[model samples]
Target: MAKGAAKGPTVASLKKVTPENLASLGVERLAELLVSVAETRPDLKRRLRMELAANQGPEHLAAEIDKRLGSLQTSRGHVVWRQKPAFVRDLDALRRLIAERLTELDPAAALDRLWLFLQTAQPVARRFRDRDRDGAVAAAYVRAAADLGRLLADQDPHLAANALIDAVAADPEPWAVWAPETLRESSAAMAAVALKAARGRLGGAAPSLAVVRALAQAAGDLDALRGSWSLQALANPSVAAALAPQFLAAGRVGEAGEILRAAAPQPTGPSGRLPPPDFAWESAWIDYLDQAGETAAAQDVRWASFERTLDVDRARSFTTRLADFDDVEAEGRAFAYAAAHTDFERGLGFLMAWPALAEAARMIAARPDDLDIDPAQAELWAAQLRRRFPAAAHRLLRAAAAAAFRRREFKLCDRLTEEADTIIL
Candidate 1:
């Protein structure tokens, strides 16, 4: 407070060094500083040349970017992982030049340059095959390829659709990037072309099916999509199951049911047990039955699914549809069925998941021969049950710890044993 005391610098006296702040240093001084820095940093030197070219006009900028892209395309030195970050950053900078700056000045010219930029992907990719194990280089090229869609957006749809398809058909590795939704909105002719290309590339393969499905859905001709699936394709349960929901959405309920029935495993030998259930196929069939208003049939499937698989979702679906008192009765029956399932761990898991802790406790207390608990799930289930049924929780923890010991997981065994002791205490 003394009159002679010096005042400390105030907040306003300090200046952050930003472009605006640095401008006070004036152009000549800043230019000298950049020249000195550029002498040591080639990347910064290249960037400076780019900025200078851009200031001259977009044509100049386009020329500068093309030169760099050409240099990258022809080069083939292996880039180790340590150099990948800088390499990817340089590619990204070129992408921004083509996508953001050059496009604003001359769109047609930018479109040509963008295509050239994408051509560098393959060469750039080869340089890092063993190096970029994390896919950084490929991902950078994918981003650059995406700009083709934006550039083609305002062009004629027929030409645009064909150009896009041809580009993909030529280098189908980046097929997904070229799949613009706008092409789907094109005429049925374009959809037909896409379907043909899809079918031609790899017959009945999943990727081809994806292309056909997208085009057919857009054109409202799901039958064409279905027809693309060969008899061989339908023989794969997963392929048949994949098409069921699309048919359901189109209200082709009978066709949906027919395909699923045809795909279901045929009655085998004397047992007639069929192979282990394909749950994905079962779920699709249940959906189809529900859509067809086959309530009683659906209920049978749901209950059967629960009994065979001890699936909690199936049990809930089966019991939830019964009349009020009927639901309570069916629930008890389902619980009893689950308790008796052949797979003891699965049965116990179903009870615990249903939080029917009392039943779960009783089941654990019985100590079935297959009493081992899954080590991963044991800690969580034990935590939930410990307060309500300490003895049951302790039993599960001890069983899990014993299993861990058998697996030579000594640390886990010790941890679980300590947890079991705490549960009983």
Candidate 2:
């Protein structure tokens, strides 16, 4: 008398069938099946087209690319929100195809076409309402530029240098902010190639210094690489931060340290609030110090930064260093300090993430009776603690439920009351 399970196989189960069986059908039936499958799965059709295009020569592929590009261009007037992603995907596929063909046959032509694609497609991307799609198109353009730069780097270094320079100079405001990490990385790669070409041209007595100067000139800054617009476009912390590794690589560790120290943010005002530290620059300095066997200095910076900010990540990192040096007492103190000063939920998370459960329990128990904690979060934490420390969990839930009741958070109070009862039972 039980109700029957849903009839028919799921699409996932249907996918388990072998393609060999489908091939056994006559050509007419196979064609019919292909139509059905293509209707159901558009991505399959796209993949098949890409595979066919890959097998064709550059001339044929170029024609196909033109056709796809034309379709996208002409469809701009009538594009709906739902159809925008499809159009962007089609354009991306065509651009990639064009780049591949042109790179293989003519690197110079590839660079020209990619530059044109960036100019044309970026406007179209900007028009789309979906920010993610715009970012995707932007990333594709940057990647294509990188590919073109690599292609032209060896064949015609000047052209490659110009192409890369043009790419970095392109306006990257909204897209860069939306997708800074990837866009910054792609821009950096292009800049690196341009710098390499400049270095090749400016071989001198002090090759490293000359190369840095040449990089400055190529960036259109006659002064030096420091504070160049081109270097700013690369989104590194500062010119000194960017150049430190290059100096270190050239066996100038002392110069690298000087550069980093000069760039380091100074403490400000009587409150001793330092300027918001550039994490990347700080990390680089710490790494360089560690590499130079200045373990104590590195640890000192790490601990000071953590104490000033109560930043959980810095605390963890400092703890890791302490553990490496077999300093368990310092590590425990670090965790205790973080737990004491950090916000209740964040402190709980930091302690739990560190798997310092005993410390977490102690911190919760020691919290002032009048202090407010989010009732829902307290209940959740109590649930997590019940498995390991039942007594502490029960006390926490009861306290949170009382706080919730006092605040007229009846729903949370009821939930916590039930949870506390369950734990006690």
Candidate 3:
């Protein structure tokens, strides 16, 4: 069965949606139907029409959920959940609001409110049905039946982010009997999250590809593992430096070089007493880098950034997030070493890995075709790898150039031929 689908026979069928008893849908299509009902909930929708007929505040309903939930403050403060009140008070208000509205409004709005309220009142939702199979909610599972169909139809990256994967992987109930696409979509979601995580590490965001892939695979949604808004939002020049090594490990040498070049200072003197990267920015960067396979470099940055965030005297577990690199049993621990106990010499050594770091000004200007294993990128990585081993960039450059020339377009051939002197063998 698809991820996120509810298990067992249909609790009840909708008016027009039942096709030989909607149970025939494989996990994927069943999930689509489930998500569809979640968005509109026909029974609830008809009820909502009655409320609109009687003139309930569409605008009032639309009002930002402030007074009920209270103020929210964070980096991404505008995300709607900001208005959520404290657990007890929020649940009380939700019950009161639903009761008052039920007297006049239709079922859909009331249900929508109930859904949103359920999301907010997690405890109540859990009590009602704690299907925390994969760290997701039951509403999400039901919503999946309604949401997946539309999501598949839209095929947009934004809406179908984490919930679908959670539904399939986390389902405690036997929803497999009802939906197959739920599992299929969950697979897609895993891949999506993986791509996103890869993009983040390579692009100077957080190193979460491993996490997404690990979690999504367990949930049966490899394709869905492609995006992470939190990680993407944190990217910048400073963050890139911290993200460099992970990018290299993940087959994104160009992105890694780009971040390091921007963040690390130009070397001075033999040992290199470089200017410190901004502590605030470097702290987060170090956290991500530590997870990206450059442990020595990560430790080095950790020392510098920790000095910035903590007092000179305090000492505890130097950690940020508890990351899972591979599988749970064969994985790195969650305690991604925080900057608090990081050492400076290790950080410095990591910086030394990149010798001629000035080459990354190219990726930002690169287009899709220019994206094949680039020669310019090869040279930069070659400089670093050959330093520790006998690695060379010449062969990689030749292969990329050859591949570029193989394309039907004459323009690409001309371009590679033109830049050969500056970048390749």
Candidate 4:
């Protein structure tokens, strides 16, 4: 920087740079010095850069050159304007010049400055694109766009997010393709920006559906992009109104349901209570339940429009999921859940674990003398239940039904009789 420039840093300088000297240099000088050593002694520069970054964050350079130049007073009136660099007019100009010089030779330094510029200075991503289509801007934005795609996999979008996306798409590389590939600790912000862009294309006013589809394809996960779009629409009201119907029309009924469910306001404090339910909220809930295939739950809510509400169907659905559980204990628990509710009279219908449940004829003869079966027998039953779920072993349950029938215990007999064809797993 003083006159003669070295393409590679001096080995002696690498060895000579002590912590004390590093501490004494101005922030700008310190950054430049770090750059000088970066090419030849990259490992050491990396360690020092990380150290400086951890110890002194962005605030360290907030005052910058303007504040530094304040020290330039003179004894004589004609202030010999000799030593100051010609372009030290302001901090902005100085920062820009320093950044330019950094990108010219220092790869590490360029990356660091580029990160800062994109995050804090001015979204230099689009600016970089405008400035140079094929220079560092090309590779940098490609990486940025890719990283942003990973980010969209997580969050909502901003107003400026669309503009940023337009700029990214204006270039050759697609954001989704790079997101999974470009994602890294050093480039996380860029990834987040890209994700924000994905939200714009999917949720808002109909942009090219093809672009969003391509984004999904590039990210290699359509469901995740839809999830991100849902979140963004929920947070932004204008976004919600404009985009909700479009999302529904996109055959994302389930996703739209999730968004509205997530948006349904909840009471904040324990001391206070939510207002009495209105028709709108009930309708929204019913919409969510229906889309999610909780028909029983939706039906119960709908019953409020007429008379007494019985959640029998929802209870049955719950029973079904419970019986479908993998273990004997889990199946027993489902009965317990049914016990507290009306739909089931604490039915043992979920008990599919009896060994004979796999063989209809064996089940008829195997009725326990003591209703309270042994733990070992229960374990055996558990295994049988698992097999029943997978192998469709209806014979054991049929046998149990016949035994119950001969004993004049019709209810118990019917409980063992399963109609697997009737249930939709």
Residues 130-158, candidate 2: write the lDDT tens digits.
65444666666556555554555445445
Error of 2 at 320 (Å): 4.9
RMSD, every candidate, angstroms: 5.7, 7.9, 25.0, 22.7
RMSD of 2: 7.9
Candidate order, lDDT descending: 1, 2, 4, 3
Q: Which stretches of candidate 1 lie over 4 Å from their true place?
A: 1-57, 89-114, 131-133, 141-147, 150-153, 176-213, 269-273, 406-408
Span of ten consecutive residues with least summed lDDT in model 2: 174-183
What local lDDT score does residue 239 receive in model 1, on the 0 to 100 scale? 75
Q: Judged by lDDT, which candidate is best?
A: 1
- TM-scores of all models? 0.76, 0.67, 0.23, 0.23
lDDT of each residue in 1-425, candidate 4, tens digit only: 66786667666775676885577676899888768877666344534443454345333333232232232211122212341222122223333422443334443444344333333212333323234333443344344434333333333334333544654455323433433343432233433445556664444333433345444434334454444454545554343433344445566776666555555545557757654343444555565566678886775555442222223333343334433444345334433443333322112222232212433223323433322323233333434554434323343344445566677877665545543223233
lDDT of 3 by residue, 154-267 (tens): 334434344333333343133332133333444444445534443333332222333443444434432233232234432444445434544555665555544555555555
Off by over 4 Å in 3: 1-150, 153-258, 265-276, 279-297, 311-425
Clashing pairs in 1: none
What's the lDDT of the predicted structure labeled candidate 3?
0.40
Q: What TM-score quantifies how close candidate 1 is to the native fold?
A: 0.76
Which candidate number maximizes TM-score?
Answer: 1
